[model samples]
Target: MAATGHHGAPLLVVMGVSGSGKSVVGAALAQRLRVAFVDADDLHPPANIAKMSAGEPLDDHDRRPWLETIGEWLAGHDASGGVVACSALKRTYRDQLRHHAPRVRFLHLDGTPEVIGRRQSSRPGHFMPASLLASQFATLERLAPDEAGEVVDVDQSVDAIVQEYVDLSAVG
Candidate 1:
């Protein structure tokens, strides 16, 4: 059965900096929740991908369109529920997403630079380079008290991380 949140359906965003296991954990969580899964990186416009692939950090101007696209996806899935893996590093970005899908909750994957840096190195061909990890971390704003979300440490196994979210969602 699909997971249900305080709302009718659970719209979850697995968010964090690069290399924080957003994709891996998000996909697993979605599977466990029996919800659809989307990696927001796949929704990026070519220009955005090109810019990031070149090792430049994306400014807000570059991210606006992309964020809008992700928001649209969330809005589309509002009733049916879905999980998205996104590097929603800033509160404003998360706010934009929430504006589109008001019932959405976030799962922030937290980890130190050293741990994430090691993971980034093992990712062979991802567009996001390890070189930009610092920028990703610098941009990250932890979930505030008002945010509808929880943070999970990325040092644990993917199953453990996914289970934690599942248990938390069950409680909420």
Candidate 2:
């Protein structure tokens, strides 16, 4: 089945703290939706990647450009849609995407540190280190349900998670 968003060109921000299964879910959602997937990690500049690889967490200043770039991509996505996995840990960052593309929606992946840590440790070569997981939680700004996006628990299967997102976003 062809996938569609709540509005024209579903621009999804698959968000979460580190290790909340953003990449996996975003990839799957993209495939299911038949839209291009953009892992916000991939949009990170080399320096940012290096910083996280060295076990340092990124600050707002460091993340702004990357978020803006992702927002830019959302702004340019086709009429069908797109999805991005990003650790948009702050309200401002999520807002930046909304500001860039008014139609943009966020799918925040939430899970406990233990759950995410185990997931991160199992994953193959990635720039983000498990050591920084706490920092992500520390910086996370929990969004209210009525706010700019939807929060999803990541403890469920990926298909279930994506279906929830797809269903919620399908509501006009």
Candidate 3:
């Protein structure tokens, strides 16, 4: 894809609960924007991964370090811009990430439990299991109007989602 717009922006965080296609869509968005891509999952500490692998929902305490690491990455890439796939399920978590990159914006991948749960079940080899989908949805807080972002429905094709994101970013 061509990078037509979205230049001079700070980091973009593709966010949602489990199975929202953050990684897939995020990578596409990064390529379209001509920026590097990072998966927040890759930054999680071993203990957090183990906890999720065992079907446990992580607490704020458990996620703080991981979130901070992601924030640091955003800070590091502020100049060049980048995209990161993270489940910034809570407003506070998003705030924490914003602290690192003040100009950070988010692309929320929204979907219903039925749709997302189905996707989770079909996936494999991830630390988070289908069982944890409930917790992820339960913890998710939709983007506020004041937030510098837009919500793209995950039901659409990945290309459509990316196009919508590009359109939105161009306007933003």
In candidate 3, stretches whose alpha carbon ends up further than 4 angstroms from where it belongs are: 1-7
Q: Tell me the tens digit of each residue's lDDT in model 1 across 38-118.
A: 999999999989999999999999999999999999999988788999989899999999999988899999999999999
lDDT of 2 by residue, 1-172 (tens): 2244454556778888877899999999888877899888888999998988898888888888888898888888846578888877888888888887777777889888888888889877877777878888888888766565777889899999988977776663
What TM-score fits each model? 0.96, 0.90, 0.95
Model 3, 1-172: lDDT tens digits are 2333444754799999989999999999888788899999999999999999999999999999999999999999988889999999999999999999988899999999999988788788878998888888888998999888888999989999999988877777
Q: Candidate 3 at residue 165, lDDT?
A: 88
Candidate 1 — worst ten consecutive residues by lDDT sum? 1-10
Candidate lDDT scores, in order, read 0.90, 0.81, 0.89
In order of lDDT, best first, we have 1, 3, 2
Off by over 4 Å in 1: 1-5
As for TM-score, the candidate ahead, 1 or 3, is 1
Specify the highest-TM-score model's number.
1
